[model samples]
Target chain A: MSDLTQLTISQARAKLRGKEITATEITEAYLSAIDRANPALNAYVAVTGDKARDMAKASDARLVKGEGGALEGIPLGIKDLFGTEGVHTQACSHVLDGFKPRYESTVTSNLWADGAVMLGKLNMDEFAMGSSNETSYYGPVINPWRRSRLDTVVMPTTHQGDGGFVSAGGTRTARSLDNAQLVPGGSSGGSATAVSAFLCAGATATDTGGSIRQPAAFTGTVGIKPTYGRCSRWGIVAFASSLDQAGPIARDVRDAAILLKSMASVDPKDTTSVDRPVPDYEAVIGKPIKGMKVGIPREYRVDGMPEEIEALWQKGIAWLKDAGAEIVDISLPHTKYALPAYYIVAPAEASSNLARYDGVRYGLRVPGKDIVDMYEKTRAAGFGREVKRRIMIGTYVLSAGYYDAYYLQAQKVRNLIKRDFETVFAAGVDVILTPATPSAAFGIADEDMAADPVKMYLNDIFTVTVNMAGLPGIAVPAGLDAKGLPLGLQLIGRPFDEETLFQTAAVIEQAAGTFQPEKWW
Target chain B: MSVDLQTVKRVARLARIAVSEEDAKRMTGELNAILGFVEQLNEVDVSGVEPMTSVTPMEMKKRQDVVTDGGKAADIVANAPATEENFFLVPKVVE
Candidate 1:
């Protein structure tokens, strides 16, 4: 049998259907990988091994009877933010530590229907706030690849004196917790880490403001943030309600496409969910990209970006150019305002959405002398410093005195950013190419916790525009940096144009070549 | 922008969160730092530009004024921390 660790969904499904492999064996392989990887990486909060095996057994039975589905027996990781019936969906916050929902999210159900096995719930940043996974109460997810020269390397952890121990395949130890090692790109960092570490084929993730794409980029994995309303948001914990959308993080474009197809469905329960027809994303698999027009957004090249990132962007352009696609230089003039506008709009919505967790309904309830005291105590103890910071900002932005000045103006700016994308797309820009992030993953300690929070927020600068515009965007591995860390190139497509984006990404994937990171972790 | 601790205290009250004076001082420092970063927005020329609302251009969908919710009240209240005989229990507000 070939390495199940490196098998794509298409290859796995084909093998499963041909009776060359059983679903149980495939799932066990992924589970074994999770067991090997999760101890050091801390990628998952829960590993549903028993349940996954049971599901895999049923899937194998179905395949034996010639009744197979697209995701038949595929192993998957669920982001903890999505409610799993009777499972802990804490969203990495202590407030909902013991809270379990009675209903499963529509997206999880859809994937299950396609025969995907739930390996377990993956960790995420608290309430999907931070760019790095350090905010997760379950702890940070370590990056998979060791720093190396080749696109893929088998290297050792860099700041090893902190606390990293020798890992599998007989790798040396690193102990750098005191120096705060680089987090697996977050708030979906756990999912990214899992896929990169070969723990699972792919995992469900949410992108409010680059939560999905940024982490994928940081981890050198492929992440796709679909058009708003492309996937149902019902049962996913609210972060910034209007901006949040569920997506997928995977090892490659093809893996992401299969996961996206299974996850994209309409649900009547979620009012924000679009009732439009779901596309067969797999149909575009292996499609030609000869006549495609790829846009290069000049605005994304922020001042002082590491020269290597700019070079990586150029390298991606050259690859696409060689693949017979026209690369057009374009401008998203309002790009500069996207971060501020997103901060305002997302918080305003969050202020209202989170109002329900005031110690009266859901979340931790602290005892106090009176009802008002109860509200105050529960929330203060339940929420962490970062979560509280966002809530306060959310409340201030939505307050009556500040509403017109902050919230209303933010709404207006939101429109401008969206219009910027629409105007460019209207002008024949099929998709936009840009750096996924300004810098590669920095050590968690390198970020001065005392420093300005806005600097931390700036990390989402390049990816936030897609969220603001309600467009589809993806991060694919472009190349590695001088330090040997992987760098990602982002592709932003027109609304509902993920098909073209995937084909273009596939072309780049073929050109830049497959990522073969040296086994570092 | 050096936000004062007093302002942090006020912001906390407005945000319905309780913070001690020490925490307020720290938060003031943090908020000021964030605001300082946000102040960079002042440099951009957004004059005469319309602000954004939703990422998608579509207006919020509206349905008929008729009530149509199908969620069962019993099921919802069943999970509440405090409930009376068929209703949610809450602190008495009006005498």
Candidate 2:
């Protein structure tokens, strides 16, 4: 009765099982919240209100029969990247305009099998190619967290002819914009926002080059990019195939664990899905991390990292050390090159995978004099600027005479990056800790990030190495910055060792405490 | 390693995406910035490193080549912009 939307997935499970709340009631609560908040947040691209109600009704019947699945009656947001049969699954790209898959993604199918209710598709970077969520075809999702007005040092009252802003005096003033609109960190920005704002108990998100973790850190939620192949990529829209992995964004570490348990499974449809039993991640939530060797990678201490982020990293180390985790300084020398290499490798794979979007098969079609012209026109019209930029880079790298210099070189660098993690992990490091992002969430359409694509790409610097290594990583909200925005610390685990991440992240979550943005919407 | 305007146009053509002269000029600079960033990969000695074919260490899983799924022609073409009797309609390639 006390705002059913506030209940974590684990608590909702108990309450639903106890018959204290009906699935329909909770579903309606979330629907009402979404209806009210979505207009301001732009989180949900398409709300499946009718389907959610029908699913909740079925869940209620199952509960009455004293039978339920692992996530029975829990409502969740699906990233638009996932294929949900007969629903919008565009990966937030215009190229897939009006496209609906006839089959569900394996990850979503698994969630439904466990009784999770679909609350509809969430927005994301078009083709999962951006870090600021500004690349979303649906307008960028607004971060629920805002910088405190009291911390304002500069404010712009009027827009200049350029992207810059100026005060009425025609000069920049030292006052921050009053509650400036901030971007929810992206590609999975919507998932992070929805979970952080309590619009959904949890949301499914994918990470390729830190899509899940960066946004989770920005929005103050718990998100994990499980080991590559932990969740089948069968129906998820392909980004960088080698780096993409589906995970969950939830309000708490325990909620994230529960959602992940339901989201991950080995599927025959996806050959890359590992043939291993999915562990009960939630069961390890409160496990003590005594004697756990938490590695502090020295290479992650990149130059010009904010003092606060560095402080937060130290806080994480101190918390883990207090929990009896032995802090060991380790070196991953290839860290600086991971982002640059990712820029090459991710775009290369993305270009090849996106070739299927020719106007012939599905989605948008533009008329031209011939088939080739039509394909060119359609693609040009369909893709956004960032998508086109990535495709261009991808195509250029994989083109004749450049493959060895760019694509091949990046792959070799990727191997070195992965080997760095292997060396540290082989040396008895249980998990590694670092700041999830270099800084807290910044303003939507911030000038610097907008001027240059590379500036935006740097947002994933701390989180991409895990993807390159094919390891599991989680971003747990550790503390608030001076501006009241949340900052998160990431924990990287070994392959198929998400249970260890859950155990370690839970410790940090407990120590730092859960964060919730003050509801401005 | 920076891409020139001509190279940008060529890459866009190879990618099957049309680009206007103005956009191509702009992309030349953007692509150069990205290429310049990734050029740092040349700094590291990758002489003995093998390009990663797969991220995780696992043998490719093989399955029977037999058709296990079909009878969904309508579903397959359901979202296509133009379709005729389950066949996708496309602009004439040879004329």
Per-residue lDDT tens digits of candidate 2, residues A368-458? 9999999999999999999999999999999989899888888999999999999999999999999999999999889998878899999
Q: Enumerate the candidates' DockQ scores in order.
A: 0.49, 0.82
- For candidate 1, the TM-score of chain A alone versus the native chain A is 0.92
* TM-score of every model versus the real structure: 0.90, 0.95
Task: Please give the lDDT score for candidate 1.
Answer: 0.81
Please provide TM-scores computed only on chain A for all of the candidate models, following their numbering.
0.92, 0.95
Residue A385 of model 2, lDDT score: 97
Interface RMSD of 2: 0.7
Total backbone clashes of candidate 1, pairs 3 or more residues apart or in separate chains? 27
User: What Cα-based lDDT does every candidate model obtain?
Assistant: 0.81, 0.92
Q: How does model 2 score by TM-score?
A: 0.95
